[model samples]
Target: MSTSLSSDAAVTGTRVSPPSESRLRSNLVLVTLLTCQLMIVLDITVMNVALPRIQADLHFSATGLSWVMNAYTLVFGGLLLLGGRAGDLFGRRTLFIAGATLFTLASLAGGLAPSAAWLLAARVVQGIGGAMAGPSTLALLTTIFREPKARIRVLALFSGMSSAGFAIGLIVGGLLTEWLSWRSVLFINVPFGLLVVVLALRYLPRAERQSAHLDLPGAITATSGVAALVYGFISAASHGWGNATTDISLAAGAALILAFLAIESRSAQPLLPLHLFRDRNRATAYASMFLAPMAGMSMFFFLTQFLQDVLGLSALATGFAFLPTALLMFTMIRTIPRLLPRFGPKPLTMTGTASMVAGLILLTQLTDRSGYFPLLFIAMILMGFGIGLAVSPLNVIIMSNVEPHEAGAAGGALQTLQQTGASLGLAILVTIFGTTSRGAGGSVQHALVSGMTAAFAAAAGIAALTFVVAFIYRNPRPAN
Candidate 1:
């Protein structure tokens, strides 16, 4: 469905006010934006820790349990572009508040859901809210803070939150699940989301709107294409790749995606402008971004299970295990600006991806009897450092090239590809783990190791490719 307002109307409807002097108000705005972003990222991993509890409470079968995540991701990824475009066409502040309200209501509904279907539906709605708010967070930051050095610092923190939030979610989810109940995980969003809505209405500045139009065909085709593809992979995880339904879903999804490309080539206003990929560095950054997260997301998924099931750790302890990684990531974020000025994005990205690949490969060697001090902790630290170095620079590179008007769309596309990679990677790795464990008489440790080894190896290969791509970048240094 298209929004009624034109971009010009959106721009002219809201007047840009003089910059306010209230530091407390500005900080509140930043906190609200960060909180919304953290909520979105945390949802991806938080549910993982509560999966067992959710299954028991809702009587979900093994196959059905995957839907809890798939439902949210599919809608979130598919609708991202449309949501971003809408933010540009409508006032971003307006869209942000609306999204926050929707998200809070969805959370309340999800917490009180009486059946599996009800919960899944709520998750899908939550994804829609996330799509509306996610891109606006970055785009609004770009608009408000135009100074280069200041923007870089803010973006670095934003990028760090995006990466580190997943790990934090695991910790928070574990504590909430252990102390209260799985339902609390959903309910917790209410107070925080409401506060964001209030602060957003007060502090967020509106921009002069352009006469932008929604690409209806592009939105429909792209969303359906991505959702279909995600469904195919998720189905393959449980039903086997050879299943008739799986084949049909994959074929249909591919055909829809092909159709989307054809439509985009001719559209008056494409949801995803094809010309964005013409820049060699942007193209490479996008590809590497996709590949880097493939193994990273899988690591979180399986590692959480390993900590609890194989290593005999309590939920809280498992959360604490990730502290080293999170700490390292936060530290690296602080150093990014200084490092980017000297070393450039290309070398930093290459080194970071290589470190991640190395860490993932090392983690593959883990067994049920492995010690946490050496195997888990050390590998996690490496992974953190790699992600910290890669993610922030990559974000800087992507946003650095885009015009201010297109920032929302660009950010949306970047996040769409990133999340799609995460979802696809999880589906494939989970399938491998499931298939291998079945043959090994349900040995969770053996299954996990097998899956993680393959994933890490793939990550390493992708990193090697990213190193080559990084060299294609013309100007590696950040603009002064």
Candidate 2:
């Protein structure tokens, strides 16, 4: 079956053809996008489970080991706007294939790395590939599912996969690290990436090439700014924030970020269109996306360490412990469409964020004697539900209100914020953990509580802010 494009002045003026074999082809596209999304999300958490092994194998110093995660996240977040623009200018399909290929190759390189430098370089390349591919996934979905109802359903599924993918990654990472080898975690991306590329080539509708110009200044400023900020935070994890170098790095990062905003406001073609945040809902969504992940990512980071370092669980068992959280998150996602119409996103998001806060607060009570059954289980469930509830609605709000022509940019910006949040959150939380851990004289239990309490307190504060933000969202009129 084929689709035909027609010019519509009311929409973007760029003609969009409806898929001829809508149901089958649409589902196929969804699967392909989900696969890509899952791979990217998995990369974030999978390495976490294997950090210890990677460190031991490569003889990496504590500061250097974080490069395994930071390299990927920094590159991915930095180049995202460029990638999104590439999709618009070239074609989403072309970019997706190229990105997938690059990602696959990088994964192969990372798997075989014999030294910390090799692994870190491979991770940077992987991030570049991910930056290219990730935005296209959401862009393709937007172009394919134009209707409100259909788009919401697709977005819900996509959002759920994204939220739950980290947990799934933990499980997969653990299984691979425990049963096969830590290297297998990186190697596993090979088959999945190849599969996504092949399926995308066959199933995705070809998009018209747009002649969009790259926002070079905006891109440079934003990327460098974010990198500096991330570097400063990570540096503070090891060097005290009062250290001259740490202060200099952070001050420089802050200046660059401020300059990035200034450049964006003046540029005709901004990499991150500042106008997207004009809508109160979108702005609030962006803020919530950033803060929500700050605590959320820290939870996974420290918790994984606690499980292995403090509780003495094998990697495999540690991964299994998170299964319940992943399951509950997926379940909550399925209910979003039904619930959105009845209650609207405001109540759901507020409630979910509150639940997450509760979970994080509960987690602060952990000690050497705490077991997985009651304390860990309850915390994981709350975290999952809170994140699940916020993620779906957040995506819907960001994409739902934007014009079709801007979908790619909006999606890219949304993802960029999400990743940046995760990276920043991890850095800050690591600092808190490291500082407290040091002050506690290396007592694992005391350090865990000190870091977790601070992290959870921040999370609760963010959630409370989100509750106020939810008030900005107007309830949609009930269906007659």
Candidate 3:
């Protein structure tokens, strides 16, 4: 494994500089990159709690409110491959700075926006920036930590940040909306983004642009295809599966994706390296990564609603309620480096998914009257451990063996799968919840609870499916 900063390894690992100086310099680089990654992840949910305030402040119609979020998802998910290709072609460090700068500026604009249209415009730019930067962050990380041990450790941190982000987004959104204005959620990214940009210029090493030809046809179809699929799912969430628009989007997406694949197979220079999918282990890892999020996201979506809607918790309280899971997840990162080398990905993946399944199974029994105490609390803890255990190893498998040339596309493909999987999963679960809730004979509270329980059961099944996937790993190899 080759790392980004040979200087870093020399300073910190070999003590070419004073150990303290070396560690601080290397650590700063890690912080700069991961902080950017965290900001992107947080933005996904941070606005959720502030929706009402945004609507009230901007005078958004009901339909307009949905686009604020949808605009970001469609653009971000759609442009990721193109973004990654641009990174490899133009230089990742250059793309990273440009992307981060755009995102930061967009955040500021969004915060200052006076009208619904203005905010929506800013959000769409934020998605573009996120698309540009997101793949580079992980690809750069994979490039930087050449040493296997160090790569695993840094990746654990990255994975942990991603896993905890959903909860933290709710928490941050709640606190900002409660203490300041809803604008604070968007405003918070500016300072951090500026810091990342400034530090990236000084601390990060620059790579020369690759000489590969851009696969324009592959890029266009892939981007449009992914964008359509994401829009379809987002539409399904709000409008249900039967909506003509949803059906049209899904069909168009599938057709476009097929076209993208056909183009890739024949292209001299593919936007996404078709060769990356040839290895069974790597392909399986990609599949598991997609499924893992698909299984887990329902818990976050439904549980948040249950807390605020059924449990009568305030926005702030609802945000804080996720701390048990968040804290435990962060704590687990510290131990992953040790556990991964010892037990290998197979056991860890199976155990992690099994734990999540058990936790979701417990959630399947929830009633409207269930408290945050025994049942909800325990479920969170299980999910915390499960996520912490599962994600790092899976990320490693997708990332571990890449040629330097393909790093950008590999990272993009990995994340694209995740984003696509999450959107589709949520759409499926939302549909399930709606269908089950409608059919159940109960009062409003009971109906909501019935839907939630049914959704959770579906999540458990997804987790179980993940466990089955992990079980199929033959002659398991140690991550180290």
Considering every candidate listed, which one attains the maximal lDDT? Answer: 3
**Reference-based lDDT, each prediction:** 0.78, 0.78, 0.86
Candidate 1, run of 10 with poorest lDDT: 1-10
77-134 in candidate 2: lDDT tens per residue?
A: 8777778767776787899889988999999999999998999999999999998998
> Listing every candidate in turn, what is its Cα RMSD in Å to the true structure after a full C-alpha superposition?
4.6, 3.9, 2.6
Question: TM-score order of candidates, best first?
Answer: 3, 1, 2
What number of clashing residue pairs does each candidate have, in the order they appear? 1, 0, 3
| Alpha-carbon deviation at 131 in model 3, angstroms | 0.8
lDDT of 2 at 182: 86
Candidate 3 clash figure, as a count: 3
lDDT of 3 by residue, 64-115 (tens): 8988888888898899888987787888889999999999999999999989
TM-score of each: 0.92, 0.91, 0.95
Output the TM-score of candidate 2.
0.91
Off by over 4 Å in 2: 1-21, 441-443, 476-480
